[model samples]
Target: MTLMTFVYLIAGLILLVAGAEVLVRGAAKLAAQFGIPPLIIGLTVVAFGTSAPETAVSVQAALDGKGDLAIGNVVGSNIANVLFILGLTALIAPLIVSRQLIRLDVPIMIGASLLTMGLAWDGSLSKLDGAVLFGGILTYTAFLIVSSRKDKAAAEDDEFTKELGLDETPKPYGWVINAALVLGGLVLLVAGSNFLVEGAVNLARALGLSELVIGLTVVAIGTSLPELATSVMAAIRGERDIAVGNIVGSNIFNLLCVLGLASLVSPLPIQIAANALAFDFPVMIAVAVACLPIFFSGFRINRWEGLLFVVYYVAYTVYLVLFSTGKPVAEVFAAAMLGYVLPLTAVTLVVVAGRAWHKHGFTGDELKR
Candidate 1:
């Protein structure tokens, strides 16, 4: 890459980090002002804010006719969020899962992942598919709002009121300041995304890499910076729910909101390159499935488990690089996946299911309640 390109890339990253900080702070302030429940704000407004970068990049890529880049970025990012970001955050400290996340958000994330896979099954995501995905987003948002209202009402009851010290009537400034923060944060998000996308595309060309590769690696990671920053901050602050929620919510948004919207703007035709179909997508699914164990077992992800995630992520990246460069890395990855990773994942799932059954019984009726 040219010196100027490197400069832009670095500058873009700085902007992304700064923008995310501003966005999160602004969002939190707004949430507090509006008397929104912490969980609601974290899952919806804050989650969307942190995912703004990914959305912007994907949309821009689609508009620029690099639909694969757009789609790849979102898919790659979801994988990174689960395996890399969450894993690293947990390595720093074990993340505690809120009941809401374990019961609601995690399942939603898995559903979104499966939905994305299904939509792309025909080797393309058309405008119609986008409409379906976007519709789901709207439905999900509506559900959250309704649920938050119920939660808020519940919190206002005698026992909850005493415990949380909630005020029945919020101050007048609540709505106004929240509006300003959301607007300003969105402005910064748009600006930062532009810079990052421009720099990333240029860098890819300089390195003689396909836009798809760039999207899957550099752009993916760059767009995911917001999640990394937010999750790490939440972990450090001991806001375990926020850390875990941010990762899960962002992944869902990446799959549904970002990719879906991009596809609507421009239909993304999947390139069934053997490597992508065989390795990349499966790796993404593997990462998603990997979380089942970490989450279901005590509904917690501890530090050691997090370290294992990071190791796997590093190994994944190395394998990608080698495969892309036409190196003989397939055998290594195949051996690892077949011999160790796949079996371990299967075993973990079985154990988690058995534990859940033992604790909650065979029927899921208790879980529903």
Candidate 2:
């Protein structure tokens, strides 16, 4: 909390946000110019671009031998993506959930989250685990590209088309300009991430906070700012597909690309924190699973649901604070959540999922019959 620490933290945050905006702008523009469809860009370029800040920060943390920070960042960002980012965005506007997301991406997200937790069970992420995770992303990306081309018309109908599409007048920028933008954005990301991580580590030591705590709270929030900005703007603009899809895709990439690559680059296995294993990882997976019922019920997230998400996030953060500080109220909070809140919530989600499944059995034609 020294002046220099605060200065670096704020400056780094500004740079991360600016860098991600530039990177996404250049990459989105270039992708559009290449005739890549909008849905694909939403799922790939925009999502990954927004997540670049997390990638840069986590990878550098791993290289610097701050494995706790690297792992915490990935885990915390995933949690924040669903609970915090999506919740906030949906509060601004109800998000239209794509059928493909419910059918394909949500399952993949859940599976990836579980796999990450499983790999870390031994208290570390090995290079082999990193390879497997990164490989999944490459394969998934290839499949998305091929499918988008085959179904170009459907892809074009996506909400991102209107958002990321070139101007109606279509003034084309040269390849050089696009490349420079991308390069400049990358430079900014690296420098900003360095400052941010350095400041965070220093602040943690000064405050007697563990690296993992700062990583989960401070670093995770800072790195995820780009996602918040992109998603909230998309939601407000009524580009709901990009808003929801951006969160889902960024969560996926944070695990597959950010954590995976970071573990690979690190000299030693990335140690997993005990608290993360006992509670946080399960919560992350549960949050991923929660989307299934919510998205399936109506193919849209309603205002009430958004509010519920926000409340849950706040509760989770409060629990983290209590547990981290070893406050006397920690046990009471944990008991209440485990004994009452979680069970009720689980029952509610199951009921909704069942209703959705039953209703879905009869399409308009079948219902008429």
Candidate 3:
């Protein structure tokens, strides 16, 4: 409500972005120096680093017994990552979906989304549930590393390595510098999270909104800025792989790492609000499911599809705002989306998927072009 509140929000966002950038750069360089493959670094370290803000914020909220904020941040972030970040990125330049994403990563993302929902079905995420989610991420990462080794070996020229300056010979004390960067980044992230959470909690109180709603909207979007920047820049630079892969990878981490770690660290189970279980979870699952058909259609997200995605995200956010404010229009808007828009989208996606599959059998890579 006050200027200081806005200052906290802005300052927190700036620090989170700066911290993530430093952490990812340092970690990527360090991984490369240690002979880790560029692809693995991109999939694991960079993705995790970009999601560090969510991890920090959620864990802090959970420790403070703000369970809704913790849960909302993770679920909302995954939604925003796909609907908002990817949507905006694709609009900037049509994103080419790699076969690997459609065939493997997207499915994993969907599975993860479902698994999270099932775990939260009981209304809270226990430490055991957290462990299960955390274990899944470990298994998934190991699988990716092992399976991608051949591809990594065959990569005579890795653009990611070159982009990270990993192609250069290591200098003396390089690891030391990288380590400092990682540490400094962590410090900034911790400090920024405290500020952001405090600001968000205060803002929620001032606006007569729940912390969950603030987490779902403001905190979620603020923390996702790194992914937004990364994907949009990758799109412009023609590194379509990074642009698409980054979003998918980050969603996975947000679920498996951010939420898992938060729940594990909390003194009590992180409770899932009834509203979240009834609405947000379903919406997140639908968004994840939607990715498959969109990616399958020509193995690319066209500009119009991007526009559709952006429009849907706006509609979704507006609905949440209206619903939270107890506006009468919320019901009418929800009715329209349910009765008309959603079914139309479902039919459109099915048609597109069918045509693409018929054009080039599912096994064929012709759509990659």
Candidate 4:
């Protein structure tokens, strides 16, 4: 890669972070002004705002005929949101699970993950599939708005309230300034995505790496920085719900909104490397499914769980690098993860779930998750 490419990549990442922050602040302020519930705003507006980078990158890649990269970004981002972002945030502070997440949002997330797997199994997500996924987001957002209004009369939750970004000591800004922030953020996101994708694709070609690999490793992580920042800050501030919710919400949006829009731009054919099909895509689904057990275990993600998450993510990334480079150790890494780590994790989750069941004694959480 050229020095200029590195500069472009760094600049793109900086723009993504700054743009997401500005967009979120402006959108959250607008939501608060209109008296929207914190949970709804966090789940819908802030969630989509933070996910804007992924949306831009994926759609841009798709338009540029790099559908594999676009699809990889969606899948990889979802996995990272769960195992990397949420895990790290929980380590910062044990994320307090809202019963609502267990009862409602997580199930939706799992369903979405499963749907993605099914749709992509045919080696593509067509425009019809995109339409269906995009439609689901619209319906889900509407449902959230209607239900959340009834639940939270005036933005009650402390965590989501803080996500509103505008303090109680509100100094009113004119509508034009807020709108300008939103528009400028969008422009930056688009420009940043163009630069990032260009740098990544060029670097991939120069290094003899496939577009899918670049998308999964570099582009995916780069776009996910917003989620990382939001969740880390939320955890630090004890905005526990938003910390967890941001990740979950972003995962949903990555699949439904980001991929949906990208696929509509072009048929996002899953013409990817075999490793992605065999390992990464399935791993993404597995991670999504894993959330149900972990969250329900004690209705919280503990430090140990977070540590395991980080370890698994590290192992995944390392395996990808080794496998892509045709290293001898790649087989061993895959075996260890598939033969030992996965089985042990499953057994442990069963134990924890059973223990939780006995302790909590079969509330509706089981039925819901």
Q: CA lDDT, every prediction?
A: 0.73, 0.83, 0.89, 0.81
* Per-residue lDDT of 78 in model 2: 85
Tens digits of per-residue lDDT for model 1 on 1-369?
678887776776676666666666666656656566655555465667677778877887777777667866887898789888999999888988666776678788888878877777767778888888988887888787787777754543342244223333555776675567667766766676677777877977787766667778887888888789878988998877778877887887788788778878874443334356666777777777677656766667888778878877777776666666667866788688679986886786668756865776524443442
TM-score of decoy 3? 0.96
lDDT of residue 213 for candidate 1: 73
Per residue, candidate 4 scores C-alpha lDDT tens digits across 91-177 of 999987777787789889989988877877776778888888898788888887777778764645565676475566555675567
Instruction: Give the C-alpha miss distance for residue 154 in model 2, angstroms.
Output: 6.8
Q: State how far residue 367 of model 2 sits from its true place (Å).
A: 14
Per-residue error (Å), model 2, residue 76: 0.8
| Cα lDDT tens digits for candidate 3, 94-144 | 899887788889999999999999999999999999999999889998898
Whose lDDT is greatest here?
3
Which candidate wins on TM-score? 3
TM of each candidate vs. truth: 0.81, 0.90, 0.96, 0.90
| Candidate 3 local Cα displacement, residue 105, angstroms | 0.8
Q: Model 4, 221: alpha-carbon shift in Å?
A: 1.3
Query: Which stretches of candidate 2 lie above 4 Å from their native place?
Result: 28-43, 153-173, 362-369
Q: Name model 4 segments beyond 4 Å from true.
A: 28-43, 157-162, 165-173, 267-274, 362-369
| TM-score: the better of candidates 3 and 4 | 3
lDDT for residue 196 in candidate 4, whole number 0-100: 90
lDDT of 1 at 307: 82
